[model samples]
Target: MNYTLHQLEIFRTIAQLQSVTKASEQLFLTQPAVSIQLKNFQDQFNLPLFEVVGRKLYITEFGEEISETAFKILEQVQSIKYKSAIFEGKIAGKLNISIVSTAKYTMPFFLSDFINANETVSLTMNVTNKMAVLRSLENNECDFAMVSTIPKKLKIERIELMKNKLYLIANRDFNSTKKKILLKDLNTNLFIFREPGSATRLAMEQYLIEHRVTIRKKMELTSNEAVKQAIIAGLGISIMPVIGIKNELQNGDLQIIDIKGLPIETNWNLIWLKSKNLSLVAKAFKNHIELKKEAIIQQHFSWFNDSN
Candidate 1:
């Protein structure tokens, strides 16, 4: 390899810390030395990796791609180093994890419990949408990801973590003539939805398609919080993760419809690269969730009328 591992390491550090000085301190090198290493790595790519303006370094477009690739390269190198260290028997490293946004509500509690139990380890979490979570996992940007959507043909191992049910929620102001709502009844009603590529949105779409329900165009939103706000303001109904809307339902800001025979089921899975050697932290997390999956699901979804 023409590019030195040190060069890739410096680039990765700068990308993460976003400052040469911070990268230098973390790596225990002088700022000028860090700058020199970054420049050398940029030269290897034949492109300026970062743009400096008024003492602030912003990663360029191409730099972001390089930084992502460099992250994977450096992480693989670290795994090798960790293996070598394990020959002497030691365990230490931060485990980086990412999860889709809708899955965020429960992840913190479980993750905190795990971290508290494992004093020798720490974790970094990236809360993003489905596409970003997939991208992060594919680029080795994260060690593992908890996501609702599993892509076809991706070389990843997935362990079912939990089955989450979907709920059609609306504000009290939503006045429907029918007692039991049907998919076709929502045609005239306003609809609030997660942006394209959201698994919840996809599931809802698939259900509508399968039932041959024609939906009127309404609002498209990105976050569950935004969808909740719109629903609370009487904008429309939405198909949302039951876990995500528990507080709203309890507060009476939202009401779940007893829509019989509608598509109401989904699952969350823990995903990781099949080809990449699994880290101890990642394996532990996967095992922990697998073992406790049933209890967690029961605790969360027990109150629902539809127990299945």
Candidate 2:
């Protein structure tokens, strides 16, 4: 079979995702291009690789074996590239990080300098909720994780990068006749929340418990962007990291509510399992963050002072 490496890579992605649309999205290729390439690859093999039943794609038994082979081949090819780079004495390899979704708003600033300095290093950042990110870290699926809430169950080493400040936010049209808004005053059902297992949600819940805050009405959204939009739509107020809502605040679409106890703060942290051995690339990346994070913060996040 005269199959190209591109065809092998595309086949691996399709096998893993089980959908042409999803594979195309992940590969940043058009759906039709993915479909055509898939057909061309399948034409080389006599046995069917995949089948569609009830509008769902299913890999054939032989297809599963081929997919595994494809995965190993791609992995070996990548290893060869990394070995070549190492022989040249270059700081090169992949850096995989699992991060709480909100960290997507700020962690790039902390990573920018190192990433720019090491042009050959590949970065894969998986942004998800805190629980999922922690799970990834616990499974050793990533080199590091960026989070605000430190986990108790893991023995980890961490560098505190910056402060994550969460404030009670409302749409600009939200009524605020009183100068001093008490937690008890927000006793209505007009509260919105991030989904449970979110670090921000946990922080909000902790503050609510401390102040005995209660809301008669509440709804849940799974992402920072969603919660921000819900608030902008005047659906309800929510506690969100200031970093995630900067543009909205600047645009006057949202306003911060200064209640008796507000702006719950936590340190943004980069953490890794203490027991895991670090690769040269991971160690170099860690060193870069530890050394230059302060300058990066000061340069990119100076507006944080005014965001408050």
Candidate 3:
């Protein structure tokens, strides 16, 4: 009750950096000034916030708990400021979005102009697997989730963003001629795959099963980047989105493995819970996407059509 918001902010910064010196540098204050404020703040608590050990600082258990509380408090304060601005006829707030790893290449293009136009709108984007993206949406933790595999169980509304094509790919050296191979022929090669919960892996599994092709061995990776690296290293061939591998494909480091009935198609969409109310910022983002999605596709994903 006795601590000021300024002190909480200062304490959070110190706890985060673990060093009064670094916190002072980041906050543009003298080290002594930071140390004094830290001392004043620490005087209120019996437990030490952080410790200096051999030139490095460590946050204590209590420090982490208090730091988390301080973060929530700051976030709430930011929401209040944004709410006030909205009442004054402004669209200024946080826009939290979680996207599948492959959507990273696409979402930013859609976000660019909207972000530039609304300088006050803040964006928090998390690029993770489809499982985590859906989990965040299910828990209502984020404003929107950009994913290709739409969930069957969740009650959600979606705006189609772009077509997602997953192609069987490999190191350029592995397919020198890029000759089309039958699905049965691929069973001989080792395959790299995204983790089980990944939508990309699910699509690959469906395609392989539909053709009755079975592999004997596989290596699993957790992200598009890791899977792409494995493929580029010739560790194995795997299905991956073209957007994530454009540079590799363009530079001849990797190549699409030609196969009959290849390039598993999916649609990328920005989905949110149908039951959830959209925030002003979130609504603005949706509106922006609805209005400019076509232009964004033309500018950023023209290669998608060209490749087809």
Candidate 4:
């Protein structure tokens, strides 16, 4: 009660941006106003929260701790607001979601429908690699994370949203005489791989190790799109999610190689830290996914069901 929320908000912004000028712009206040509020906030603590060095701002250890606490407090406050709104028979709040890059193929369509149906709800989506999404879930930075491969080390609750299939893909021009290639045949072919920390890459590697199949040469690409482009350009063949290559496959730009025991099957899981309390919005989104998951798959990815 000693410090106002406005002061904490200003401080948090400054800490995050590391620039008074940028914070002021973000907060839609004058630079002098931001400086005055920051000074007053620091005065309440009776210590320097951040230090200026070489024309750049750096948060002190104490500042970092305070900033983290401020975020938790703000998050709780938002949850309280959401709870109150729900009690009044209104569904409205912000939803923070982190998704692995592979989920980008289908997540947006589902999210779009959710957002459209709930006009008052605000949503933030962070698309990144699997490891980063897991870290965000562990840090309680996001309400939910969508991933293909769940890590055993993290104690989290997960629900299978949909099935993901990884397929071997090559350029249309690549000639192969066999209808069904043996896994060992890939030993002589160059392969394009996803970068480290990618769930797709991990799955592919595990399958190869299990079958004792080894690729002759490999190139690592950072993103699914980049890997797809590399394959299209004849850089090398890659194992990619079927969802990611829908357009390319439809256009005849890429062809799926029918390797025996290919098309690694995995489930797309929606995960959250078991210890974190779920806000109303988070619970609503989870429920929404559970209720509409099958419909979503059938609509956007019907081919998957038909083929299976």
Candidate number with greatest lDDT: 2
lDDT (Cα, tens digit) per residue for candidate 3, span 8-55: 888899888777888999899998988888788888899988888898
The superposed Cα distance between candidate 4 and the true structure at residue 129, in angstroms, equals: 1.0
Model 1 C-alpha lDDT versus the unseen true structure: 0.79
lDDT of 2 by residue, 122-154 (tens): 899999999999999999999999999899999
Ten-residue stretch with the least lDDT total in model 4? 299-308
Q: For candidate 4, write residues 55-168 as lDDT tens digits.
A: 999999999999998888877877787777777787789899999998998789778788898766779999999989988888889999999888798888988878899888
Q: How far is 210's C-alpha from truth in model 2 (Å)?
A: 1.7
| lDDT (C-alpha, whole model) for all candidates | 0.79, 0.89, 0.87, 0.86
C-alpha lDDT (0 to 100) for residue 164 of candidate 4: 92
Question: Could you give candidate 1's per-residue lDDT for residues 123-233 as a string of tens digits?
Answer: 789987888888888899888888887778588988877667787888876765678886667898887878887887888877777778777767899898899899999
Q: Which stretches of candidate 2 lie over 4 Å from their true place?
A: 53-56
Best by TM-score: 2
Model 4: what TM-score? 0.72
Over 4 Å off, model 4:
1-88
- Ranked candidates, highest TM-score first: 2, 3, 4, 1
Which residue pairs come into collision in candidate 1?
Answer: none
